[model samples]
Target: MSELLSIAQLSVSFGPVKAVRAIDLQIRRGEAVGIIGESGSGKSVTWLGALALLPGATISGSVMLNGQQILGASAKSLPGIRGKRIAMIVQDAQSALNPVLTVGRQVIEALQLHRGMDLWAAQAEARRLFDLVRIPSAGRRLASYPHELSGGQNQRVMIAMALAGRPDLLIADEPTTALDVTVQAQILDLLRDVQRETEMALVLISHDLGVIAEVCSRAYVMYAGRIVETGPVDQLFAAPRHPYTRSLLEALASLDGPLRRPNSILDGTAGAMVQQQGCAFASRCPNRAGVCSHLEPELSAGPDGWRVACLRADVAGPLEIVA
Candidate 1:
């Protein structure tokens, strides 16, 4: 598949605090890529910065979509690109949707803006989109306000509105965060089905490894505003090269095997602190060496397009080396 989007040296800063450090990422057409990490790892900020969604953020990056630069582009050009070519569905569907407007009106507005359909046609298309997202009572639900629907139904409505634009790439940021396990499965399945049918590129951002594993073929592990590991989902899960990655996998409870005790890395979550030098994860990393405290490792290519930033990529299993 050809490259649909490329983000090069992307970074975002608020005053003296840098939320997203320089990072590079690419998404291919019709591919499902996931960004997984603990909260405050710059998973969502990467895209938000790319799309110019963060206000008061000093963003420095080159975001290219099909060879056209999106970052630092004129304000007038972004609106056309945002919903028409690229769409994003954030967590908290209730907050995303306007309380005064009916679900149908919201979807219709998107269609009218992007597809340029008349009210009558947009309403018809909205109903179809409601059906496409598997929302029951599609027609009736269209006229209902966001508060009138359940959380799952509201999320489905958000999905419907996003799909109404028929975007080429969809970024879902913790789309199932507020739902029950059953509903989460349903939403993930719906996203997969939609991607398959539409052939749209998908970027699923979540903290849940299981959620990413369910819908994404490839995954990127982020830590402290940088990508620590990336590879095919199966390979990375089976043999994680980075100590952080291994620690994250160890934290998950296995269904078939005996549950391994979670590592100390899982004990407490911390926001990315100011790191003038050295590896950002060195403070919490079990494998931290004298070098790790002084120098940051670059993301180096590994076998089969896999990549790791750890200096001791060859070291497998839990680390005995401590800072």
Candidate 2:
């Protein structure tokens, strides 16, 4: 598969606080990539920065899409790429959708903008898209408002709007965040199905490792504002080298696993970006050492593309060396 998007040395800052720092990632054609971490992990901010969507944010980076440099591009050029080439769906569908408009009208508007379709053609395509996302009574539902539908249905409508653009890439930022367990599963399955059927590259952002594992073959784990680990999901889950990654696994509650009491030793969540030069996770890491507090680890891989950035791990790169 060809590389669809490439982001390098990406960083976002709001005033004195840094939200995302030096993020490097790539997405290929027709593949699913997942970003998982805590709420403050900068998972969503990275993409928002990449797309130049963050207001009052200072973004310094290179974002390439199919060989074109998109980061910091002129505002006039972004519209051509945002929806027509790449679409996004947020977590809260109700708020994202305009309350006054009918569900179908919102999607139809996107169709008209991105697809250049007339009212009749856009409406027809909108209904088809609603059916594609598996909404029931696709035709009649066009008149319904966002509040009139269930959460799942509203999410499906949002999905339809995204698909109406027929984008080559779709960024889903916590698309299932506001749903119950069953609905979350359903929405994930729907996203998977849509990706497979359309052959569009998918980037799913969420805090749930299990959810990422279910939908993506490759995943990136973030902490603070940096990507701590990136590799095949199965490999990371089976053998999580980073202390933070392991802690995330330990945090998950499952019926199949034994019940345990809460354990939170970290002083704060992963969202804060400080001026400290050392590793951001060292403060919370159980394996913290003298070296961790002074030297930040560089993310490197050994040709296999499994990258990790931890002074405690044997991840310095092409040549293996014990810390």
Candidate 3:
């Protein structure tokens, strides 16, 4: 299958800090890929750079959508392709949506700009989208401002706007973060349904591995600004090749499991603090070797579509593949 979106050797730098470094990722037509990482790990920055919204950020390498380069496209020319071909649902809906404007108007404006629908037509399409995303009383709600809607409702409106342009690729950065567990599941289901109906590729960036496991067919784990492990979601979850990936799963487990031991807190803390060196997880990695502190490892192919960027992958045990 041909890729709908391809990002190769892409890097985003903020003067002295490298927020993302030489990342390579792809999303095939109608496929869902997840990017999971801890806070400040460049999960959102990677896509922000792709969307050309990273202000004062220096970007290098290529971002191609449908065989066209968007990295260097002029802003004037980019809008013609941006929302129509690619759209993004930002993490914070309250800040993303205009507080002053009615949710209906905001969503219709997106349709008007890209799909070239007139006022009445755009409003009709916007109401249709509201129904599609399961927001009740669509007609009545159309007159409501952003402040009037609940957090989950605002999120639905945001998703509706993102879909208004009928984009070929959807870049969602923690789209369900503000929601409760029940609402979160519903939002994921809604996104999945929309993707299938539209035959659009999805790039889901989240800090929650469980969310990624539920929605993404393929997954990439990022650390300090680099992709540490990548593979099909089930295989990586069953047997994470990178130490950071392992720690994330373990941390997730700790959240659900009993915390009888003191090590539980310690282990969670290990996954949080930054370790800037050869290996970002070297300070806390159980299997760290002498060379791990001096040499940063490159991603190497492993079994079953698995790729790990670690010097100690050989000793990390045979990663069990989920059939």
Cα lDDT of model 2 overall? 0.87
lDDT: the better of candidates 1 and 2? 1
User: In TM-score terms, which candidate is top?
Assistant: 1
Query: For residues 1-323, could you state the per-residue lDDT of candidate 2 as single tens digits?
Result: 99999999999999888888899999999999999888888998998889999999999989999999999889989888998898999879989999999999999999999889999999999999988999999999999999899999999999999998889999999998879989889899999999999999999998888889999999999988999999999888877778788777766665754532256335555535867778998877877789988898999784457899988875422211122
Ranking, lDDT, top scorer first:
1, 2, 3
Which runs of model 3 end up more than 4 angstroms from their true locations?
254-277, 318-323
Task: Compute the lDDT for candidate 1.
Answer: 0.88
lDDT of 3: 0.84
Candidates in order, TM-scores: namely: 0.96, 0.94, 0.92
Rate residue 86 of model 1 by lDDT.
93
Q: Poorest 10 consecutive residues of model 1 by lDDT? A: 314-323
lDDT by residue for model 3 over 91-177, one digit each (tens)?
989888898899999998899899999999998999999999999999999999999998889999988998988898888889887
What is the Cα-based TM-score of model 2?
0.94
